[model samples]
Target: MMRQTRLNIRWRLTIWNALAFAFILVAFGIGVYQLLRQAHFDMLDKSLKNRLVTLEESLQEGSSVEDAIRDWVGKFGEHSDYFAFVCDGLQNTVGATATLNQVDINRLLPNLINDYGGTAHDSAFGRIRYASREVQSHGQPLRIYVLAELEHLDEELLLVRRTFLFAIPPALVLSAALSYLLAVRALSPVEKLRLKTDSISATDLHERIAIANPNDEIGHLTATINSLLARLDESFDEIKRFTADASHELRTPIAIIRSEAEMGLHNDADHSRTNKRLSSIVEECGRLTNLTSQLLALSRAESSINKSNMKPISIDRLLTEVVEALEPLA
Candidate 1:
């Protein structure tokens, strides 16, 4: 039972520590993942905005939508991850609109919003983010799209996700193990208290605990226990002294009564009836004397007191006086 109690408390401490550590770790991982995602998307959006500005600049020079888009693609294609397309008001392809060779403009047209960059999903290209601008080309209204693939963004997110997935479990395991060790270390004092309490019994109240830190709660508890033991020890000593004194006083009286009763039986003037009564008195006195001795044995620890308050008395006279003061029971 003592072992079980210790284990239960230690296990609970370990569990709570591990849970707290896990919460902090998971929250931190989520925060880092979010920051990385936002940074990547912000970078993509900035590049898309820059590409749109270039396309708008080309169109402002009075070039047709197709020419502006073609020029913009030519300039950025060397180091760019963007594509350009020109479409008419009916969302139809304008001149030489093969700028996005793999991307169908119609697939992108339905998902576009006005003059702002946003994400759109497609079956072939997976996901697309684009910024659009309206331009007047030779008095014909046209729209230019600056788009980039979001597959790599997803890939980056997946990599981060994989990193957390791969790292968190082992981190949690290590955290739990460390938590268990710390719990054990911190609860060592408590374990010692348990062992001390288990070893104590009513006979041995002299044991006490000593801690290096006396200002802590455990120290206070140990002090309280020691105080209780002190009280019990004092009380037990008092009880023992009382028992020994009682037994000694009782034995003296019992021996006096038995000797007097036996002397009565030997008296020549005693009738048969008085002799029978004396025999009964002697038997009862013997029993009482044995009981008093047993009490003295049980109260083995005794202390001597100053007997200057007491005086010597004659035992035979005291016995005679006691007999004269009492009558036989019917």
Candidate 2:
């Protein structure tokens, strides 16, 4: 028994649309997240470099660098921007707007000054970000470190990330809807073909599937199915004609045999003559039977050949068997 496979075009379209939407969502999300992160970090570096330049100018002027830094810190501290510290080349703290803990001054300060000459170094101190800068002032090299807490930046980034996350569902929904609409538009001709196929029946097998677009695969499929239907319709018509012709041709011999048999039986004829007529009638009946059986067998064999599952047989043996079987008839 053959199991029927049911197809639902809408379900197929929905699944494919969802997959495409998911791919676009993931790609866009990753791109947006990376771009935002890069922009945020760049802004932080630029702000730090600008602050370092201002601090350098104060020191070069021989003004009280501490007071200048304190004033600047006072102005910017309310904004929660950064903390600054100035140190000599010997790693001794010369001036600082904000006091540093002993460990930070000892361990991290020297490393920042050594590695980056007139450059910034970003580091983390207990969840806070510090952008440290080394500078030269009045022919003397100095180190200036700026500490800016990243909690607020992280919070904002988190908000942006959450916004993106929230946007994804809507984005995916919109994209899926768009994809489905597009797929439907693209497959409109296929849908029409399906409806036409459903309308087709054995009685209307001569009807061909309509083709709206000839360049597409669906159009090609429509053309091929229509061609197949045409062939099937032609074959059925030929079979009907052949069956009618064969019946007509066989009827005369069959009627003649029946009439001869009846006449022989009715007449009180000689036994030998009666036997001869009976034998002739029997031979005619046998010939008719053989012809009908051959037609049926040929029809069955043709069906099997079309299906292409016939077992391989030796042609020579088959021909010999056919000749032997027909010898009695001959």
Candidate 3:
């Protein structure tokens, strides 16, 4: 039972610790992934918004959409990774960059007016991060859509997911190892206590649990157990003294009964002396019977103190049996 209890404590402690660590690791990984993803998307949206602002400023200078596109191409060169298009209120494509030709533009932008603001998703492109705004271009209201291929961002997110997946197992393993070590350390005192307790028994109640430190919890526990052992040792000593006293009290009566009986048997010719010895033997036998009954009662009381029920003994019946045994000598 002690071994089983120890195992249960150690396992519960280790498992609970490992589980708590795992939860924290998973939560931290999720939080980091979300923050990184949000930051990436925020930067992408800001860049697209800035580009729209530049286009609006160029249009305000009385430049045509085609002229603005030409200026942008000359300044920044061609980037096939980004696509930009301008559509009039009637949904007619007025201006487009060279990158728009790389992908299925119709699939990437199903409805130029519908793909207006925020972000859009496509099976082929994964995430089409974009910014759109209504702007005045050459005395006409135009909608500008700036779209960027999210393949790079998606690749980064995938790498992050892979890193989490690979890192979690090792992190959990390390956590479990650390938890086991902590469990062992925490239960070491308990193990010592158990060993001390196991070494004690009925024959060796004088031995006590050694207290390494008197201030800690384990130390207090050991002190409590030692106090209990001290009490038990005192009780055992009392029982031994009682037993010795009972034996001493019964020995004289037993010796008198035996001696008087032997004298009566050998001096049968002297009737008066034989009768006197018989009377003395009978008196000693009564004392012996009383003493035996008192001892039995004491033993029964001690035994019954720890039991649920006490079995009553017939003292009269025991005395009758003792009298019958003495009848032969009479």
**Deviation (Å) of 226 in candidate 2:** 1.7
RMSD of each: 7.7, 7.7, 6.0
State the displacement of the C-alpha of residue 209, model 1, in Å, after optimal TM-score superposition: 2.1
Regions of model 1 farther than 4 Å from truth:
1-7, 78-80, 95-103, 113-115, 136-140, 197-204, 267-330
Name the lDDT value of residue 297 in candidate 2: 68
What would the per-residue lDDT of candidate 1 be over residues 1-330, giving only the tens digit for each residue? 565535476788788888888899899999999999899889888988898888878877898766776787687764335677777788777743354552466666777765676888767677888887788877778877877888878898999999999999898899888988988888888888878977888799877777657899888878888898888888788897786777676765565566657667677586775676666576557657756665555455333322223359899997975574344421
In model 3, the runs with Cα more than 4 Å from the true position are 1-8, 74-77, 101-103, 111-116, 201-204, 269-283, 299-330
lDDT on C-alpha atoms for all candidate structures? 0.74, 0.71, 0.80
Give me candidate 2's TM-score against the actual structure: 0.74
Q: Which residue runs does candidate 2 get wrong by more than 4 Å?
A: 1-7, 60-79, 98-114, 117-126, 135-141, 178-188, 293-330
Winner of 1 and 3 under TM-score? 3
Candidate 3 residue-wise lDDT at 235: 84
Model 2's alpha-carbon lDDT is 0.71
Models sorted by TM-score, best on top: 3, 2, 1
By lDDT, the better pick of 2 and 3 is: 3
Q: Which has the greatest lDDT?
A: 3
lDDT, candidate 3, equals 0.80
